[model samples]
Target: MTASRLPQFSGKTGRPELMVILGSTLTVIAILGIVTFLLIREHAGAKETATRSATTIAQLIDADVLRTVELYDMTLQGLIAAAQRDDLRQVSPQIRHLVLFDRSTTARFKGDILLLDKHGEVLADSSLIEPRPGNFADRDYFQAHVTNTGSGMYISRPFKPRCDCEDSNEWRISFSRRIASSTGEFLGVAVASMRLTYFDQLFNSLYIGSDSTLNIIDDAGILLAQKPYLEHDSIGKSFATRPNVVRILREGSGSFESVSSIDGRQRLYTFSRVGNLPLTVIVALSGNDVFAAWRRTALVISGATGVLCIGLLWLSWLLCRELRLRHQAEQELAQLAATDSLTGVANRRILDLTLRHEWFRAQRSGQPLSVLMIDADHFKAFNDRHGHQGGDEALRTIAKVIAANVRRPADLVARYGGEEFSVILAETDSTGARQIAEKIRMAVQQLPKTEGDELPMTVSIGISTWTTQTDVTLEQLLFAADKALYQAKEQGRNRVVAGS
Candidate 1:
């Protein structure tokens, strides 16, 4: 058979394989895209939940801190009021102390309450009946009160006592009221101190995450207190220049996400100013803690998605391989069905199909189509001399020679029957067909003799061509070729003849 007749088999295998690969790839991409989109949305939700939680915590701190400041302010006001009483001077020292320090005892984390003179001299103290001789002329609260007579209650930066007192190293902040005359003349200051541990106690009651922190800073960016302090000495240190602190103070009251300058870990910082006070409370929740659960879920989902997509692709590959194998098997079956087993060329069925197909094609295109009928010479006598196997071998050799001479891609060679073969040459005229038939006849006649064979092999070929002017049908065309083949056998053996 010519290569052109068998072109369709090679091309059919790839279409199924390509379709399978394309479909599998598109499925994998869609799965990944959908998974990625869902994971992104889930991540956003985690962040939003963390933000809301931080905001709630910050609000709680703000409310608590504001209430505490109000208590301290009321205490300072009461102390100032009692100090200006003229009749209090005539009372006993114990009674005067009781009246002046009346509201101070109700304050939580109270350190000391002091009445100072205009020169910042301690006039009376809550810890002492007469008062300590400590001078507070340079204290931030005292200087602030002295500098502005109309200043409202003043809250000082975090500080440690300047004396050798037992708790002198403890951090504290002071709240003071300016003691003034009715004419607004500065008289002195009444100040109260609160331990910074108050913030620790308050923060400990809240359940922020293990890696997160709660913080309080004064308006000056001075670190007042922190829960589970990141830096032991961070208290009383001014973080005014730190980027995160600067943003917190600048925005005054809001929330943001940033990397912590202390540890370089990301955090969600939710902050709010304590009412109108010069204090801000910050709830810094660790990003890892906030998203840990979400990360775990995403990891599991991503792994499963990866496996699913890979499995799908693997299955697709297996299916494509199966389809390729099946197609190859089908092609092999089709080849066997159309081929002569002995000659290894197309069988009679294929010859008839080709003739009919080409007959119509030639009729439509007005092109000449030729058929060559070939017969092995004296096959019956040769078979009796050399056995059936030898006769079959000679027939195979003759079919090969006929196929060799008909080499055009648009031509076909097939076994027409036992010891008879056929060839179809598309668009060939009578002369061309006869020339090919003579070539096939000579090729078979020149075959090498077998070791025990009495005579060499030979064949008779007959040519029949259909042109635009020929009115013969497909059956008549084959009959004419067969008849011409008989005529070639009768005239002489091993010769070529053309049909009328």
Candidate 2:
């Protein structure tokens, strides 16, 4: 015989929402951390690129200026040699003027040559019909050359030309060197002037960014030139008091972030000193431009992560739903497995299980356990007369009456097979079992026959009781009840008989 199976489960509630929320929270935190790291890495990479570009641009400008100044210095050296070697004072004025001012007047860069005396008095001029009367003692280039008498070139800050100019009146910077005698006595200053357009035009070909800037400042924090070109410029402004200038002065070359003193926008500043010329080139890129690409990437990543989290939550919901349905299905299957398909009572499987368990319980408690085996009498003859469908109806009606008779919670009524049914009554002795069987017999006898040709309805019940003194096995109890049922059928039916 099969044993009873009743599925059980814990009645506590599940926390799928909390679990899903916890998982999504961790995922969001991880994504944020990755996004943060990527932003920082991109910022650093962009800063490095700006630094290299600025340093390269500054060196290139320094080289170009150096070459341009050297070219004009050669012209001055020629003039100085002419005065020393060729006795340039003995040459005709017209030939000397043509020789000195030809390139200066024709060149696009506006390179002007000037000769200044020891006291910084103008001796000659290239872009002039005649030497203009001007005192140059206060000029930085002139003073530097006269005092040092150096072989190298001296560059001055960008300023307006200190002369009457009929040509383009653009600002210019001076490059000067000392002219000395064979005895090393400083005689005059040889100077070459270059317009500010030279540096500004160089930047015109570059495409840094909309919010980008380029500045050329001296070691003393004096503004030399900048682009895009400024009108009514701050060319002469000295940055000696500015905080950024102090930083630029400390480091020869590096990159940093700071707010612009000019416009107050925070920017990435890449700076470098210009070729030992005491001129620093600073490239400032707005913070927005530098982080624009990274921001876009972060946006895409965030959107994708949000979608993924939604998908994960949906998956979690689906799983919880599936688990609930599975539990319901499992409970239904267990009930079906233990119940009779035809009459909806506990089947033989459950009856046998309850009988065995109650047998042991009765033995332990010194209480009585009773079993009643019931059968519809002459059921085969009834089916033959009224048809099998009528037989099924009679069996259902009798099973219902039997169930009604066994009323206690510890009592179980089961369909054994065909027209046979059984009842398990725990803590019930022979007298109580006989009373229940008699009641079942009287109830089944009263069922109104549904078919015209049906035989009279009736039941035969065989009762078995177990107590502490009865050393009977569960199988022996069932066998004894079955024997009593056979004997009742043999004798008259519709009666109750107790088994030994």
Candidate 3:
């Protein structure tokens, strides 16, 4: 043994092994870098495309709504002028005769023409009612019309007819103007009630794929018409209870997401106010549907990323293993930073960033902004009735429902604190804000309540409207919503109330 002492191998200086390891590591790093770059580019592109698509759809819907309102205004003006002259009998005859004799007016403005007195009493109607002596004096539309002395027009929320119709109780959207006597004293109201079905048909014509839908709500947030009408109390109920819709109305216009009150489908929504009218036209498409293309792109990117990662691993084993490991660790860290740990929705940090971006956009566009503060009613009571585990489940379910109801891509719904959530509605107004709150209320009521609880678990919503005077401060909006929420809770639980 002493005669044959051979040189020992250090295991660090095998030229062939070193070269193989370096080459493999370099190849993997290069592949991963390329994949990462491609993924980033694709993500940015897809997001931009989605934003543009949403914006375009919003503009189109807004224009259509305004046009429809303008038409309504014109019709009201004509009817009022006729009423002022006390020539309803003559004009009524002409409208009926035109419907019978002329095909043009019949086809275009497809509905029975009607004349109502000062109190919304039916004086003359195309569809003849027995005795012709019913009074609509108590109707909100009639009251509103009589009071509006301003040049602005008055449009009513959808309502069912008091008189029985051959057709089932159909919803009608009415436009009214005050009738004046020869001396210019207010006498009565001249009104027209257009069947909401007409709007249903109109909105149905706008096709944006299978999951897309269009809806119209009055200034009060009552759903006037929708395609594929699902019968629920929500159809004629005040929208003020819906947190999401309230946010939209207060903001005056823009997009948000929410669960469909009808079918519970999660939707991305965009809305526009009818210029010079208290009406909102909302267009909603399922987020899943809208982003299906982007999802596919992401999946492809993900798969490529995985392959690149595997390649990196292989290359690291053959090349500079330590360096490759360090690089991979860094990449993972960045991903973690961007992701939310709980609920999988974007975290508050991300929301803050988004709010800032949205704020600037809204400011440049000169649109109103609103935020909703939502609190689960008697959540602690629920927890007391059912253990913490049950409470957790309830919270999760509520969160999912709230998330589903949000209707716009730009709208953000976030868990603000324990048992509280916030929704951001852009380009809305006070009346619109209240409607949304009511919608949210009805939606939560539909959810399964805790068993054996003294009272049913519900949500209280507070909405605050923002304008240029308010500036673009999230804190101000939040405070406004909080104050409104306090009022809602004070008035009663499970209600939506608005802030000043």
Candidate number with greatest TM-score? 1
Tell me the deviation in Å of residue 262 in model 2: 1.5
- Backbone clashes in model 2, listed as residue pairs: none
Q: lDDT of all the models against the reference?
A: 0.87, 0.76, 0.67
| Alpha carbon RMSD to native, model 2 | 10.8
Task: Give the clashing residue pairs of candidate 1, or none.
Answer: none
Give the alpha carbon lDDT tens digit for every residue of 1-500 in model 2: 11132212234356555565677668767876886787678767876776677667666767776666556657766656554545556777777776655445433475667878888887777866478788888988877776785677777887776546564467787777788887889888877777777777877766678888888888788877777643356787788888888998898788889998777878888787766676787777777787777678768877886787678767777776776677677667777878887777888777777777777788779898888899999889888987888888788788778877877767788899999999888898899999989988988787776557454599998988888888888888889899889889988998999998
Clashes in each model (backbone N, CA, C under 3 Å)?
0, 0, 50
Q: Which ten residues in a row have the lowest lDDT in candidate 3?
A: 1-10
Q: Candidate 2: which stretches are off by over 4 Å? A: 1-24, 46-56, 98-108, 163-169, 229-232, 310-500
RMSD of each: 5.1, 10.8, 40.1
lDDT of 3 by residue, 2-62 (tens): 1011112223334454666767667767877887787678756754565567667656766
Compose the digit string of candidate 1's lDDT tens values, residues 36-83. 999999998998898888888888888888888889998998999899
